[model samples]
Target: IALECILLLILQQIAAPGPQESADDSPGIALAWKAHQIIRSRFHLPLSTAVLAKELHCNADYLGRVYRRTFRLTLTEAIHRQRVLAAEKLLISNSLSLTEVARQCGFSDTSYFRQIFRKHTGLTPAGWKQRYCKEHINS
Candidate 1:
């Protein structure tokens, strides 16, 4: 009877859901979500993998891995995407110069901003603004 009870306990333990099985409840998912929130709220500030990891109190490499796994993009890519979205809004809503737009969007270098903006938007900042203005004015 003692042997049967021990075997049953072992089987129950084996069948139970462990931390690995409940991926949605894992810390990595939480960390990734927190990182996403931080990026969304602070994208206009300087940020990076190390900066985010420090803010989240996790290892930078681990944060990078988890963020990439959860979002299918690196931290740098996510930051750039957020910055580009902000730039797009500024480009359309006002007459801010490209350099000012870059500065306000957290890009330290106007040239790099142009490159990344073009990469994500398929148009230069000036070109995008011109097109947007023309389209909206005609409407």
Candidate 2:
């Protein structure tokens, strides 16, 4: 919701409504959006703050600071969050193995994937999948 609001505000500021309107020409919103989009779109890849900064042509610290300030979370956190979300869907709907899910969701190790998934959802992937499947079956 906050992200949507920022996008809307950026859109509104991009084109002034009146002849005397003052458009806020700050690139911070756009840059922040770009970083968010990259995380969302490329969550399956091995990405880092330095890699993102290089792609955006900015210093790593500056990018992290700006992203944190704009979104109230670090870019790394956002990426992990997104990856876990994606993994949930894959786990529930697909018959892929745990290692495959982890690999597809940008995790290099299955243990790490389980650790992160457990951290976010408080359930192991297999446990979550079992519960989800049972619920759907009963539904």
Q: Assess each prediction's global lDDT (C-alpha) against the native.
A: 0.85, 0.83
Q: Model 1, 1-139: lDDT tens per residue?
A: 5985795467445534477667453588668779987998899899999999999999999999877766678999999998998999998888888899999999999999999999998999999888888889878
Off by over 4 Å in 2: 1-25
Worst 10-residue lDDT window, candidate 1: 8-17
TM-score of 1: 0.81
Give residue 68's error in model 1 in angstroms. 1.0
Per-residue CA lDDT of candidate 2, range 21-76, in tens? 33342365456668888998999999889888899988889888767756777888
Clashes of each: 0, 0
Q: What is the TM-score of each candidate against the true structure?
A: 0.81, 0.80
